[model samples]
Target: MGIVLFALLLVAVVLLEVNDSFLNPQFYSDTLRDADIYNFALNDLPRSALDEARLIAPQYIDPSLDENPLVSAGLTTGDFVAALNRALPPEWVQDMVEQVLDEPGDYITGERDDFSTRIQAGDRVVLVVEEIKTLTRQADAYNLLFEQVIFPNIEDALETELPFGIDVTAERVAEAVRRVVPPEWVQANVEAALNAVTPYVVGETDTFEVEVQLSERVDVALEEIKSILLESDAYDLVYDEVVEPIIKDALGPTVALPFNITISRVEITDALREVAPAQWVQEQAELIVDATGQYVTQETDSLNIDIDLRDNKIAARDVLVRLAREQFDRVANDLPACSNSQLGSLVTSGLTSLPECMPSGGTAIEDQVRGVVSDTINSLQRQIEDAVDTALLAQIPDTLTFTDQTLKDQLAASGASDNADLLDDVRRIIGEGWTYTDQDLRADLLDFDSQDSVDLLDDVRSFLSDGWVFTEQDLREQIGDADPDVLAKLDDGRRIFKQARTWRFLVYFPVLILVVIIAFLGGRAWWGRVAWAAAYLTISAAAIWITFGPVYSALSGGGIDRARQEAIDSIEPNHDFANTQALIIDKAIDTGAFIIDGFAAGVATNAIIVFVIGMLILSAAIVWPRLSEYLYK
Candidate 1:
């Protein structure tokens, strides 16, 4: 009977341990609530999901499009994943998990009908789109696009398409000059000249006294012309017909020349200067000033007239004659001698030889000078503008101030209208983020029993259906035509799991009664009974220590790690989905190991408590005989 009872007692101990460790709802609740498990699912699971989504994203992009649409919108794969992670935050997953586990018993009994209703998966999609929009709206986001794509392309276009080393043409030079110094300003100065020269041209002052200075070349030419006239065969005719008349005109028609007497060249030059064409001189002076002003600043628009009144032997008499004749025709029109054609020709020819009477060449000289000056100025301007553009472009890659509107405007100006239009489309997509409601999602995604809707939401629903969103109905459909016996066994396990909550105490009470009965049957005296109880407690404690301490540690120490590695190794290599699955398996194993370690520690603690209590009782039993004898004395 004692042996039978001891066996029965051992059986009860085993049942009690099984009930507390496995069947108790509190055990499962505590394990599920373990911080390591909660955090692992919260952080690791979503990370794996995001990693898988990233690998799958490229496959989903439309093949016809030349590039990824998100890339066009300035979103990198990493950026999109970050935004998605933000949208479906870890806390959101934690809340959902907590809701599902709120009543572990309901789950144990398979009675929880609200698991699918805890958090709508479509809400996560909407959140993801909205989060992407928020990211795109940031000023820094535009900088990324500008730096990585738009600005570099624009720089290349400028280098290739723009005329950096512009051809220096006359027309282009004139345009550059006009841009810096407007034609209107030149015309205004010309009008001022007209005012200054009007008095002289209309002959308001014929006897006007003026000091004249001449350039060295002009002075030599004038002296030579005077000598040629003095030695010419027509010298007497010129004196009688042109020189004396010009002197008479200057001296109020009263001045007379002593002809038959030799007239000095100095007197002739002096007489001619009195009747010089002030109007023509003023006009020539204005042209020179205008040309010079284009390149150099002029202090005053004034003319200095110079003529040499000296004797010099004529070297080129014919050339001097020709120059004098041209000037004579221009200034001697109103002179009496100029009425005689032959004599007028001689006097004009003589006057033309003077430097003061040289032709101004209209605008030919001015245009040439203007062209050279303009070309220089334009080249410099082009270089400066290019440098500034390059500097601004370089800064764009790092600075956040380069906004979307600015980028759009630049792209449009650079003839990238297509890219500009794409930017607008991206902005529109971001601005109109996540417009669908729950009803929309239900009609589009959840109500798949009816005709399938073909839209963005529907596509999203299809993608998520692969792994994320599923219902109990889905599971039932997947379990279609399974063995009836297996189904019955599953049902039976669930029923037992539910009943074990209350029935756990029945097992506990029976184990307690068995322990007491075993102690009573194994001993007679009170000390013996105490010793027997101590023995049972010590044995049970030793069994627990051996099973949960060294033995359990040895079995589980590297087993979880090995299982985790094996699970990971089982996945196909070089595949994103498989890699993500491996991560899930790896973290799940870690969480399970953490919970198991906690359970083992709790069991060891309980064993240690039982052993201490048993030793204390044994000590009391050993001292009881001596104490009782002392009491009897």
Candidate 2:
């Protein structure tokens, strides 16, 4: 009976202690305050959360901006989060964690109705916007974005997608121009015209206002073209293209391109003046003197242009007219002045196929040739303009003014209206400076009651919903098929936990009364009572030691390891801090296991100590009587 009562008392003590460990507020508070868990939550969790948010943020951006160079390059969630992390105070996160830690204790002790804390992300959102403003204002930041991200992407796109086959350099462009307008064709045409006009130059006359004839003029014009090409950097580029292979072979692929080539409208106009001088082109070039103009901006190392020749029709027409005038003046001076004697010589020499030196009835050869050439140039002006414009536009700029308005305009032009509008909205929100405060955020974005105090969860839910309504029915549907019995049991458990401290005293008094009754009933004498109590204690302690020590470890050992591994596995591989987060999780699990192991070891040690005390008392009870009898004998 004594042994059974002692066993009952041991079971009661174990149950009460376990219940107190779980239900007591102090147990949780003390455990959470431990250095390992406290530091892990404080230091690591917030950064991991921010990283996780950055990874997922792209999904929420407008799909239209997915392929946008800015979106792909300058507008990155990682950068935004990095800025936020820099601007955000470390104490803010610490305060939040401290508040959250208090909630568990508060809820358990019935001090709070719910286990939720309000984390105001509004101020942080404003801080991020302010950071963006700061970034926008800095020239170096824009330059970095252009040089590092935008330019590289543009280079890659040009290299792969351009029709010039892999190399998108200025040399490749010059080579393509050479193919389209071959230098050989120009030389051949000039030779044929010079031969046709040679017979007309009977003698060199000092009286002639025009010293050079058609062929000489064409040669001078070609020289002018060459000079223009050289001045515009095209000559060097073409030279590089021609000798690139030889250089590569000699250098064994170590040689880089000389520099990133970019030709603006000013370069094109200057080149045009050499070949076809005209007033309108000069005027247009003067207007666009600031090669770093907003409309013709370049954000990358490689040339990427979207040309519309309609905007430059007058300039194109002026180029054509200048070319025609030069050709006409050449023909008029030399072709009509051919002497009859020279014509006869040409016939006798088998160089003439025409019936007369000039057409009969005062018809001039110069007028006919001039008309034909003008018609030809007019017919092919579109093709000429396209080729020249392409070459000009393909030249990327060395610098660009990166402003918010410029970005918006570019985005809108590229069919990213949503992104443009989004930028506008951001600009509106941020304004000139950091204007929005916490109270303003609460007033605008969050919901408030009559007293102007916001309910944390309600405000959070409302803000996240973005004006979408979610009723009680929606919540009920979400939580469908909840078991009533489970809910009732939860309520019962809460009540029991709430009254545990009072129940602990009740249990302690009953166990003490039982111990007293067992001691009295076990034996008649005081020594016999001590022996009986000691035997009961020894048996009970042995049971506790076996149960908490080896038995508990045997059940939980593999499970703890598997749980830790599973937790580590659950972290996403794409997370930037995946390794660190996994380490933190592993450490947290190890810390928890350590706590459990420590508790079990402490229980086992106490059991062993009680067992030792009880065994000593029982031994004394048996040995003392024998020792006394031996002494008496």
Candidate 3:
């Protein structure tokens, strides 16, 4: 009976102490604050993550050279101008500008090949402006020529003296004058006559009737005034006395000065150049400008441009421009038909229409072209940023997942295929396949997962956003030269994290009450019974601590800082795994170390709880005799 009772008490002690050490929630919760346990888990992270990370891709979580290809694109305005000209060609641009200039007001109403077709359909302003300008120029030229040259010459000729004699009659003198006239002069006169007759020739007028009437009138004049008109001496005397003075006084001031005025054709042209188009004409020009701008703006907005992964710059515009410019420059050395100044103008003209900010002679098109490309680049920047974010986020996976295929490919890419042990070691550490996610990333490594990439990837945010960062790490030791197979066991052993919380503190309280009740009923000597029960509990609790110490120590990586850094070497940089590798390794070390330390703390807490409970049981046993004596009295 005594032996049986002792065994029952021993079972009760084991239940109370052993459960607290290995399966108690209160102990494990406190263990989270344990520094030594956290340090141990922290040491396991880098090796654990890389062992899984190496197989995937560098771009997924790593920063790679390929992602920054735009760094070398180096596009400037000059390059843009050069490349755009080649792609679109300056000749096409020049001709298009000429066409645009010549177009009429109603673009849609004109011929397809005409300038009007190049403008917006609703634009008729350009045509109206051009027409008014052309008419104004004609009117100015006519006024300059007639007022300064033709009118004066005619007035002067009308005042010239005529000889009068029996043989040198008016008609005879006129014939002599005609014979003396230069043949070229005569031809010129004939041409002038033809020009005067042109309107009449094409009109509905009676040419013969007027000529016959004028002939009859001349015959009547000869019959009526033969003495003065037909007799040359008589007629000369009359003209000098009457006609010359009268004509000179009336017409000389107006027409004579013009005949004497000697002005060059160049002066006339220069004067006309000073004249600007009318206000109405300018309004029309504005419409054409608006239409062209709308078209160009639409074209630029729709332009789809992306920075190539191979371009080695922020965008493709620069590299493309540079190449085209280089080619053009090479040809330019040979004095290609176009001069430098001419080429520049052609390129500018080809780029677009004149801008509001530019003068008529300014390089608006070139500026506009640059603006368009810049707009495209700015737009692409956002998309690229978003795509990069998606790509990096994808590296973590939505569901928890990992595979050895990448690890295998990584091994082959590194030319390390000869090492058969590396693959097996990696497989043991990460397992064959595991799907992971953001939850895993945010989880504690010692608790289950030390948000694997949270440490190293934290620096990635430095470039992404201006924010705070963790900096303390001089004393935190990392695991160095650890066995993969052994660490993986630790990863599995962390399952205790879940198991420890199955029965909470409330459940354990009832069990404690039952143990005390059984101890009191089993023995009449209260001191002896409680003392033996406490001893059994203490022994059981101490056994758990002794057994778990080495396992937790191995998990903590012997307090070394670089235990499994070598494992990270297997991963290769690529599109999928692009990360700042050195920073990640360091961060992983710090994170993994801290996590293992937490686990160690939790374990120590459980040990402390068991030890404390054992001591309380022992103290209660010494007091039980006095309490029982008092109760019985």
Candidate 4:
């Protein structure tokens, strides 16, 4: 019967495992549905709708259109042809010019008048028309080239590339010069330009170039530009490292390229969608467990039997419960005792309220009683798991597998039958931690000797905490999933917890009874008996080390290094954090509380286990009188 019962227990555990796998948070069902719906909408949308909206909305300015000098001309292909035709001289003017030149004698009426003189007026009219035609032709050619190549290339380039190194423009250069040059230089330019605008002649192209002998002022402006470039590392790097090389390669000479790049800050809005749905299903399950496991694990009143026995006395279970609650009340009725040590009265004050431990009247009280017990059990389990996790987390190389192993080890560790098994379980959890995420492995990287590195880790954690918003949306669009690591961890944690709970439920009562018996009759030499007394003390000390020594050491080491480096690097060194450690004494206090809690739970549970073993020994020691009678017969 015992074997059958054990087999049934095994089967039930297996079934629970299967159910957990399917129903957990990291499961992919909901996300898959969402993905399908999103894809359908995208496929059904009209192609032209997006384009028409963009045209109406004018999302961004066309840099090419803005850069063009002829925007105001507003000339189209048709306008070019009309302008060309209008520029041609009238047929009558052309004919008159020809006739006068061919018959110079008739036009002059005198031998002294030459052909050149006769047609000079007509020649002027023809020349004006010809000049107009030439200008119109040139404009037409420019417009054709702009349409066919320059405009298209600019548009395509804008779409395909990030802003390059250099963006030189006349105004940008002028702005650079204005920023640096003295007031005297500006006054000189104003005076020089004013002096140069005299006796302007028509049809004199050379006059414009000389007017802008503006080169002398520009020379001074160039010095200001060079100075600015020299001051900016980014500018110097772009000019010397990237642009200079590219220009030298193409032009067959080393050349300095001037660039005036406009920098616009653009952000990629990441959403939490990239996590695979399979993984997500797992994460979701884990998250649910993380959020609620403590409540469920700690619910004591809901235990199969609401029974408590103390001091070798057996009364109604409810009566025992009342006695326990009363004891707790008496202890907490006054302000908690305080010591003159570190974080002294703070912990005492924090513990003054025992609402979680207090048993009110009625169902709430019943529930609270149960909750406290269950929470106690869960707390013990958590302590064991956390110890294993911390040790393993330090050793783990990856984060993805770390959480997975930690979850598994937590379940198996709870079932530990002896000291060896418990220690083995701890080691297994650490070994398994090797498989977790890069984030998990890198958690200690924050303990690096640099605040900058620590800050980077913080940023990553903050990003995760913020739900990876940008990636989430993209995942929604691309594959239809949300980030699932947290959810998966929660799911695995819950399943392991539930398994552990089930085992505890099956064993707790029998174990408690047996422990009671052993405590009654077991000899002093029983080490199991010794375990009950010392389990908490050992665990409590370990917790203290974890909370105070290790944690403090990790944080302080990094802070000190940063202070030292900054001191060395400083021109006028100020060692502000030099001797001021970042250590918080409160962490040690918290550790103390944690140790107390761990001790309470471990001692209580082990007492039951030891009691069971003690009872068996006592039974053997009593020598079953019936067995002696049978032996004599």
Strongest candidate by lDDT: 2
lDDT of 1 by residue, 575-633 (tens): 75786687778767876787778667666666666678878987888788889999999
Question: What is candidate 4's TM-score against the reference?
Answer: 0.15
TM-score list, all predictions: 0.40, 0.42, 0.22, 0.15
Question: What digit string (tens of lDDT, one per residue) describes model 4 on residues 202-252?
Answer: 111113221222333434544554443333333322323322232233333
Lowest lDDT 10-residue stretch of candidate 2: 203-212
lDDT of candidate 3 over 1-633, digit per residue (tens): 333433443344444444544343333334333433333233333334333443454344334322221112232233333333333443443443344333321122222212212322111222333333333332333333333444444444434332222233344433333333423443444344443333232332212111111221222223333333334333222223222333333334222111122222222122222232234223322332233222222322221211111211123223323333344334323332334465455556542322222112336654554455345434544443443233222222222111233224333444445432354533332222223333443454435645455554444333223322211121011211356565445435434433433333443454355456656766567677677666655555565555446566665574444454554564575523334454455556655566555545555556556667878988788777778789999
Q: For model 4, give the RMSD to the true fold.
A: 59.2
Q: Ten residues in a row with the worst lDDT in model 3?
A: 470-479
lDDT by candidate, in order shown = 0.47, 0.48, 0.38, 0.35
| Pick by lDDT: 1 or 2, better one | 2
Point out where model 1 deviates above 4 Å. Answer: 1-89, 104-130, 138-499, 508-522
- Deviation in Å, model 3, residue 567 alpha carbon: 2.9
lDDT of 3: 0.38
lDDT of 2 at 158: 44
List clashing residue pairs in candidate 1.
323-352, 323-353, 324-348, 324-349, 324-350, 324-352, 324-353, 325-348, 325-349, 328-348
* Model 3, residue 209: C-alpha shift (Å): 74
Highest TM-score: give the candidate number. Answer: 2
